[model samples]
Target: MNKSTFNTASAIALAAAALAGPAVAQQATAVEEVIVTAQRSSQNLQQVPLAVTGYSGAFLERSKIEDFNDLRTRTPSLTFEQFAPGQPRYTIRGIGGGGGVAVFVDDVYMGQPSMSSVEFVDLERVEVLRGPQGTLFGRNATGGAIAFFTEKPGSDYRVKAKATVGNYDLKSVSALISGPVSDVLSAKISVIAREHSGYAFNETTGRDIEDETLAAARAALRFRPNDDWDIQLNIDGSTRRGTAPWWDLMIEAPKSAGKSNPEPRRGRNHTDDGYADIDNAGVSLNANWDSPIGTFTSITAFRNTQSHNRANTTGLLVAPLSDVANRRVNFHTLFIQQADQKAEQFSQELRLAADLGDRFKWIGGLYYYQDDGVANRLTDYRFYGFGPTPVDGRYAYASTNETKAFAAFMSGTFALTEQLKLQAGIRWSHDEKDHTTVASGKNFSGFRDGGVSVPGYSAASSADWSAWTPTASINYQVTPDVFVYGTISRGFKSGGFSDGDSEKQSILRPFNPEFVWNYETGARTEWFDRRLRVNATAFYMDYTDLQVSVFTQLAPNLPAVLVSGNAGKAKIKGFELEWNAVPIEGLNLYGNYTRTESEISALISGANNLAGKKIPRAPENKFFMGASLARDFGGMTATGRVDYTYQSDYFSSINNVPSERVLAQENWDAGLTMGPAGGAWSVEVWGKNLANELHVVSISDILGDAFANYAPPRTYGVTLSYRH
Candidate 1:
């Protein structure tokens, strides 16, 4: 359907619901209340002055939100995409890039994007905080933050298991067991395994590509020696192996070098299959002590990850072949790239919180973090079809990076009167980064004299930066069922060097940090005797020193390299509306809408004049609506749910080229579940992307050729679950 028609329909549905809500409200029940920790403390969702979306574990399971990608579909003003397999990126409110948004699991920061694709297993809830979160988070959270809270070990013994079978030979199994080991000790364990057949056809191998196999497990131990202190330890690990999706060439290359494919879910490769393998593991220790003065908390964590990938740079099914010296050569076979990367991080955090009577409360913390990583890559552009030895045009590089950071933050709230409050926060952060690289190449094409040999060279660079971010807000309780708040906050992201390029100049040049100031006002209200809850927010951001990545050639004869640079300035304004209601018994409804506008106001000299261009991955309009109904029949309960989502068109790059635009898309999902009331067993039948819409998630322009990656297609499954 067209945009106009879809919007009109959405408006009508919303209006009808609003008109009918009060008439039936006398019989409706009160909506359930949700508690969140968006501000580092537990508070009612409706009372928190920030814009956050929360989903309970039960809701997630009912909606079949199995992964991070699925969660993004239900959150307003949030977008997720992958440039390549194992590389995940998130954008919120038109602000995103490397490290723009941060992810946390049980308060432990995740420093690597490769770990962002974790499965949702045994989670208590997931919270998505929109806008800047620099003061409390104190990291690279210029856009926002996503936090996952896992289920903790309980004193009672319990067991839960679930199994799923779906189309394309999909199979998944997950289990969780929790119990008390002793009077003062409790433990829990959770494990999951999933495998699925490929969705894209591979004609060359006569086998499907983009298949996946994954396994993950988590173990936890909690010790409560006495009422004054408690300690908890958690260990987790995961592994993934998958055939990477082959890029679809959207534009034909010159001289028939690469073939174009209009189909998004089809692949044709003349050479080896593209694939990715990733492994990640982490451990964390948390301790809490209650003192006469206040409460003290400490968190220590360590994580490590490794990944390897192989991809066909030129997605070509066929190419012109020629014979030189009685040897057959095909140029398409020469386009290949491989990379290996490893990273590890360690962090420590200490916090103290206290309540000064009932009028004032405060929290303060100190954080220290360190990380090290290395990456190796090889790119070949020579015909290897004739023999084992290639002619020329080969490049290889190894790069290493290290970082150490320290931060101190404090936040507090003071009640001025019975209905008015003031809140303020500040964070001071210091970061040091070091980078080194060794690169070498031979017989590069388009260089002087048709070829040039690059000797092995090493480069090193180091830099340090510091920033102070702060926030201030005022909240007023208009009534027992209404709240209004206004806030001004600043966010900062650290500066770093670019190591993707083989050139020394690009490796040594460090980009500046990015900063943004956000001004937002929001209102939360409940009507119809608490049966309906509606929250609305309007925000404007003054963004500066945006770090952008661009591929460019230093000189006419040099190869193009990816580099990080700072853009002049930009402006972003947006608004969001979220509502939840139970207009009648046995029925629940929820919906959200987001409207955003982002434009670059200035550009660096010598760069393309993109002052009025839209930011990449920032869609203008997004909407989601879902409904569920439950009924009792013959001592059993039956529940049915349906959801719909729409996303407007967006560009993949800052250049805003037509070929790089991702078209507007819509999706639908549904599920039906049945089980005995208060029973131990249940069954659910579910379907996702029921309409089988083909939408592009990412696009890249390489040497005048555009390649695109498509989202997953239709899938249906059945799940059986048991609890004790």
Candidate 2:
């Protein structure tokens, strides 16, 4: 995926992406202002000092964002993939993990992969923080964070209801009601139900690849006995049932390419329909105390999640097992996987802040977190049939994993001068995990009558890691509306054992924890009477044993295991530029661009040289822009906006080979909304992938069964919303 330096292809792609984002003329009006708290304090989007992106309730409706996972393509610079398929696999600037991404629900961490099941329905806003977040927050935040703010109790008594219907026979209902329980207390409750027929049909089986339904609810109470003290408690839960298919539809090449050659030129098409269910519940308490010395805050949270899913890969209609050529006789056409997991986490934090003197002010905090979890998976493989007959052999793997973790952290800030400030922080964290695998006792294809005889493997292993990380930052105000800053920080991620000898050990590595040191500089500025603002940052990071995940061929019915290792010298440097301006009444414009350079200086034996190449999932260039106009007529308001995002070609695998074949696609989404202020609500229509262009995303390079995943197709929908 590395742009070929000194080559015409790289130059052309860069030029095209440079102009990818829209360049709009300033305008006026925003769709119900977006609010965010990237700095740990509630504030309007425009007032946040960091690079932040907030989507208001109104915007979410227009974008057809139904669940928490739908936020992927709706936002620029955001991309997600399920390494484990139904999990929250978040990647911002390609910064998440193979284990999944970090999710923050109302400032509390999800803690583990399965815990990401937190639903996004009845939410007030979603904020995406786009870089290392060391100044605030907790957990493995090296890649920044995604915050989902559920509906909260307001100062006024209110009742709101919303509903929508769309294709796939999709229908939804959401409502929120809040009012005073007494003079000193208030409560709010919100709920949502989503039902859809799913987007899958079996041409031969007379079945759909997908069918799913879900419902979720939340209740919260706020007690403000006085201005100096307040308490808030929230309880939420959700349940889902049916198959949520993983549709990575591929366009197979003409039969001429030959089934023997599963290459880019000769394609083999295969996909799967799977089922999943999830039940989740959580409770949180937030209490604040205002003292003359400073402000004291206490937060305690507990959550539990149970999830299950079943799916098959590389399964297609029964076909010839022989006459397949080099790859024909040994490959598998149908394989199934089932996973069940339970996760729970509890956390508490106590902090104090105050303005000590004119030259010095500080904030300090004590934090604690614990995680306990278990995950079990079973996989079964069916090989090229002996003319459509099912056989029994040695092929099935079942594995279980147990995990635990704990951490403590604290930090403070000091104003060195009227125009200068400095901050420092440190954290100590520990994690432990154990894994075991047993033979599923299922027969294989060649051994018995049914799929038979793969010997079950019984093995167990455990690993633990501890690390101390420190962070420092300095900021200087250069002008009334301009500031410059620099930061030096460290990031750590623990590794697990991967004993290729066993199924349970094959998927994960028992390697030591990886650490990274980062140095950064950035600037924030505003000019033209606050009519325009810009923010940008760049950084260089050094890695020692930076852990990475790569696919490794395993046993029959079992997909390639995800391997971990300390890949040598790697570096990532990127810069982001965003501009916001309003040149005149009724006109608003925004544009942003991100350019990243990534390289792997070395590779393990038998692995291709990825040195000087763009890291997998790291796009060399990304751009976004939007312009909207607002007009008021007879007390009603109308608005229109168009946004575009362009990404340069990227590699989907670890190999840096030139002919792997990934595409560069530019997508645009536009919307229109009209409504009266404080009235019923608004009506909107929106479209994504407006050009209806085809794009290639990830591709498997395993030699015998290669395939490519495509991006979403052109989709358009209409929405209507009410305020109360």
How much lDDT does each candidate structure score?
A: 0.81, 0.62
Instruction: Give per-residue CA lDDT, model 2, range 301-382, as digits (tens).
Output: 9998888887654333434445446564443345566778777888887777777777665566767776666666665655
Q: How well is each residue in 1-724 modelled by candidate 1, as lDDT tens digits?
A: 1234323322332232221111111122667678889998888989999889988887788789987668878999999988666777889987777889999999999988876667797998999999989888968899999999988897887676777889998877777777899999999888777778888876777778778887777889999989988899999988888886677787654643455655766756645777888889999999999999899999999999988888775556644556565575555434567888999999999999999999999999999999999999888765433345645577777889999999999999999998999999999999999999877775243222112434656779999999999999999999999999999999999999877554556567798999999999999999998789999999999989987876665444332455678877989999999998998887889989999999999965235687998888999999999998888789777889999999999988877877678889899999998887767677999999999998776787665567776777899999987766
Which candidate's TM-score is highest?
Answer: 1
Candidate 1: count the clashes: 0
Pick out the ten consecutive residues of candidate 1 with the lowest summed lDDT.
Answer: 18-27
TM-score of each: 0.91, 0.83
Query: How much RMSD separates candidate 1 from the native structure?
Result: 8.7
